[model samples]
Target: MTTAEEIIAHLRSLRNQRNIDGMRRFGIAPTGEQLGIAAPVLRAIAREHRRDHELALALWSSGIHEARGLATLVEDPRQVTRGQAERWVRDCDNWAATDALAFLLDRTPFAEEKAHAWSTRKAEFVKRAAFSIMAGMAVHRKELPDSVFLGFLPVIARESTDERNFVRKAVNWALRQIGKRNARLLGAAIAQGVKIQRLDSRAARWIAADALRELRSRR
Candidate 1:
């Protein structure tokens, strides 16, 4: 068994100060220990270890940015509980960590429920997680019906006025991903974007314009 300490040490060995600086430049200011390791490298390391629910929990508890990311990759979706998802989401301080965690959570059965619940949160990152999870589901969960995503459009429109950079970007991402899912969804998303365009807020207009452009281009 690869111990969490051993994994942490290995991650340290792979750290690059330049990458850490680069990450900071990109706004990935991890709240805990940030090794500055690139995501692809961490993903390759995760592929080696595969699923280890316990190890994933330990890694996440370590508060190392890359370790938490690795935890998401190695976590067994079946073992992921709603409580664990909620706990980890509250710890998210950056887009990279939040998006990675959301992607992992999207694989769990609790995804849809959490997506709607978290989007209503006032915290910047928590609300972003909601839309991030929706984007992940749109990309990965092929079995989900169009209605599942369509139901999210109203939430997207309602939250489109959120002027936070992370929140609005995520809202746009979810809208675009959902629209790209299929022809039916594409039409629905475009219509929703048009409605969002009618809103007075700058954020809503931006979200609507961007989503409509992409959704229309895909048609």
Candidate 2:
């Protein structure tokens, strides 16, 4: 068998049904197969096979939760294509996989373009990926100017009424991360959050309230 097949076999061998139950409790139910291995173990495995783009593709095709997470770690961000990112985002079913993929995609060249494009999408996970990319970029892309994130504020406000658990949480995450970036952005983010609170939606209120609390605390 190939190295990818061998690694997948090893992952399956480490499956823990108890851990699977715990993961489900945390809303990480993958639509495909899962071994229920914890993230640290998957990261360790990925470290052993770093920068294996082909292997990452094969593992993603395996449709196992842990393997997909591993793919995010092992794949070369520079080698990732916009088409590939779109395809992977479409396959995401759980927050764990979606967020993991977003983290990887955030490091790619197409991140900013896709983040804006996908944010407007109506699909739950796709939209979640878009904001997840924003959140990841807020933390990771230090060179980006505040204007980029400020531009996203309108998108967050528009989507605040979505009411989907994943989408709302991700929107809040993006707002909070951008706010925490600096003093100036903190004020801007808080102002946006306050505006979001008045939007007449339960999800918007929650996002605004939570972001305000965190942004204020950092002041």
Candidate 3:
């Protein structure tokens, strides 16, 4: 069994001050220890571990930023319980980590339920996690009906008023990804964007414009 401590020790060896600085410059700061490992390298490490759910849980409990990301990569989504998801999501300190968790979370059975649940949160990263899961689902969950995503549009619009950079960007990402799924969704998303544009918020207008730009280009 590959131990979490062993992986963390190896991750310690891979630290680069330059990479850490670069990540901080781009607002990727985590609330805890972060080894300056690039994401590609972490993904490679995850490939080595594969779907070791126990190892993933151990890695996540370590509280190191990159280890949490690696945990998301190597964990078995089938093994993800609602309690585990809730616990891990509270640990997200930055957009990058939030998105990493969201990608893994969207693969789980309770993804849509969580997406709707988290969007109502007041915490910035937590709220952003909702749309992050939604965006991930748009790309990966093809079996889902268009109406599933359609239900998310109102939530996206509601969140568009959040001026937080991370939250609004994720709102735009979800809208854009859902729109790109197919022509039917594209039309609905475009209409939702127009409605979002009508809102009295700078964030809403920006989200509308950015999504509309790319969505229209797809037409």
Go through the candidates in order and give each one's C-alpha lDDT.
Answer: 0.94, 0.92, 0.95
Query: For residues 137-211, what per-residue lDDT tens digits would candidate 2 score against the true structure?
Result: 999999999898898888889998999999999999999999988998899999999999999999999999999
Residue 195 displacement (Å), model 2: 0.6
Tell me the lDDT of candidate 2: 0.92
RMSD of each: 0.7, 1.2, 0.7
Candidate 2 versus the native: TM-score? 0.97
Q: Can you give the TM-score per candidate against the true fold?
A: 0.99, 0.97, 0.98
Please say which candidate is ahead in lDDT: 2 or 3: 3
In model 3, which regions exceed 4 Å deviation?
none
Best first by lDDT, ranked: 3, 1, 2
| Each candidate's clash count | 0, 0, 0
Candidate 1 collision pairs: none
